[model samples]
Target: MIMTKELWEGNAAIAEAAICAGVEAFFGYPITPQTEVLEHFSKRLPEEGRVFLQAESEVASINMVYGAACAGARVMTSSSSPGVSLMQEGISYIACSEVPAVVTNIMRGGPGLGNVQPAQGDYFQAVKSAGHGDYHMIALAASSVQEAIDLMVLAFDLADKYRTVVIFIADGAIGQMMEPAEMPPLRPVRPPEERVAWALTGAKGREHNIITSLYLGAENLEQVNLRLQAKLKKIAANEVRWQEYSTEDADFLLVAFGTVGRICQTVVREARAQGMKVGLVRPITLWPFPSARIAELAGRVKGILTVEMNAGQMVEDVRLAVEGACPVRFYGRMGGVIPLPDDILPELDKLDAGVASGREVQS
Candidate 1:
């Protein structure tokens, strides 16, 4: 039976949902705003006979994830911004080996050891290739505790289904928020299937299998690149997810993701109350971004506002989606600062007025 409970923080809800999803292993290090995730798992997974390890460093922890996933176990790890950077090498390794693993990044400010406070600075790193090579992490952004739970569960399934890494991205505000959530029932673990012709279990009477990204010959490397590209095309076709609010009659559209998207929702409501036609496009899948949906809205709305915690990363995608049909603007706060609804209102008003004036306004 499923149980409903209240979790006061988004990280805790994600940990709980992983447990419910029958995640068998978790290996990670501690980091601010994300520490609660490990803490919750440490206390809970043990009683259930699940494996939980606190590795010496982020690098070691992600390597452990790679090792466990090779054995066909459901594995996960989490960190904040800086620690996530440290795990990039292992993430790339996992991608190349085609191992399924879930990684959650409770993002904080940074280029270095910047701040423990929230920021969307890692947008490019997470959705684009973080380590090296042509690879993509299935990136999901959560705006609330419920979304945190829902996406973590989905992340695990997608990782295993696609044989790739999945990233759950949330910021400090969403990680710290309180909400009621329905806890899904624990899933039963199925024993690993017979090793595929490719999986590297033990050789044991079978042809030895190698898990590697190294293709020394140019032709072989080209084939690998082609295969990966095909997989990405399929992912884009099947996995784009988003939320739209008050879009039908909107003259102004807002594009945002993660915690910033939730804030934009409030701004949209306020703008509507003031007799302005405003709407929102919240991208749930950050990697296979909801670009097509944004494009459709471009034909209807007068302008688009791309709000983020970073200076302007997703703004580029919005611009691409809208093409030259509508003006695209950006409003953001960086280095651990949050953009307030009051602060966002003026930008919305300016865009609304610009639409009225017949002058093209882009920010």
Candidate 2:
């Protein structure tokens, strides 16, 4: 299959990816930095006889997704920081109910109603707890328009494989930035009988399959939690994905993900040009974080610097990975600010200076 590469905004690539991946329904409401996703689905889905609804609100939208998912449909929703917050309760329910749905968060700055500009402030809210629950979802981060498209397909597959919600998270910069990307051929829609074994279809010859998060009895609830925990473990073991750049032999390591990881890539090259041994480890799966890789690098590198668009969220995870094997420092720019190589180089320099002076690196 020949895929013609064309220029596309990040949001457009994501929307197109879902369409090509055979998503039958989209339940979304508009929010800045992510509104284009809803706009695209609204215009394009009708041409394919698919469903796209601009629900009254995010709350209603997520619930709509839940209904679609239970019926064995490929359903999805897109939202920004505040909007995703509202969708969490619904998301948690989806996870516990074992529904396969693809969701996207084109994250932005947040506290209450934070600005709509690009920021990675939703890191903890997404990776740590997509919603409040004992379950884990397959959380994938995309750093570029192309990766976003690729992961959009993978997110749906993983969702279906595990019968769970999968989140494709990218910061606002990637959502709005324009880049050339290739879209794979449209996938054939799954037949109703073959889509899922336990869809909420009416009882016929087989026993009816019930879908709910509530397991009222104590023993039954504990058993459900145990099964969920086992699934999470399997996902972590098999799905931890990351990319290592120039870390073969380096004195310093830079850890980042999403758009910030892309920035750190340039910093790595520039630092390498200046005869500095700098490398980067970019996590693609944030929930089943590449903890083992970070632990391995911690022993090899003299220090690790975590650069992010938030004050410092992923840094906590990095520190946990390092376990004091080496120092883990943080540098960030919040409220939709994008960090540049210049902004990050100083942090690396401080690590070197700290080493030379035998002093602790100031974050």
Q: What are the per-residue Cα lDDT tens digits for candidate 1 across 4-73?
A: 5765577788898999888989999999989999999999989888899999999999999998888778
Q: Which TM-score value belongs to model 2? A: 0.98
Query: Ten consecutive residues with minimal summed lDDT in candidate 2?
Result: 354-363
Structural similarity to truth (TM-score) of each candidate: 0.96, 0.98
Q: Which stretches of candidate 1 lie over 4 Å from their true place?
A: 192-198, 361-363
Runs in model 2 lying further than 4 Å from the true structure: 361-363
Clash pairs (backbone) in predicted model 1: none
lDDT of 1 at 140: 97
Clashes of each: 0, 0
CA lDDT, every prediction? 0.88, 0.91
> Given candidate 2, what's the lDDT at residue 96?
91
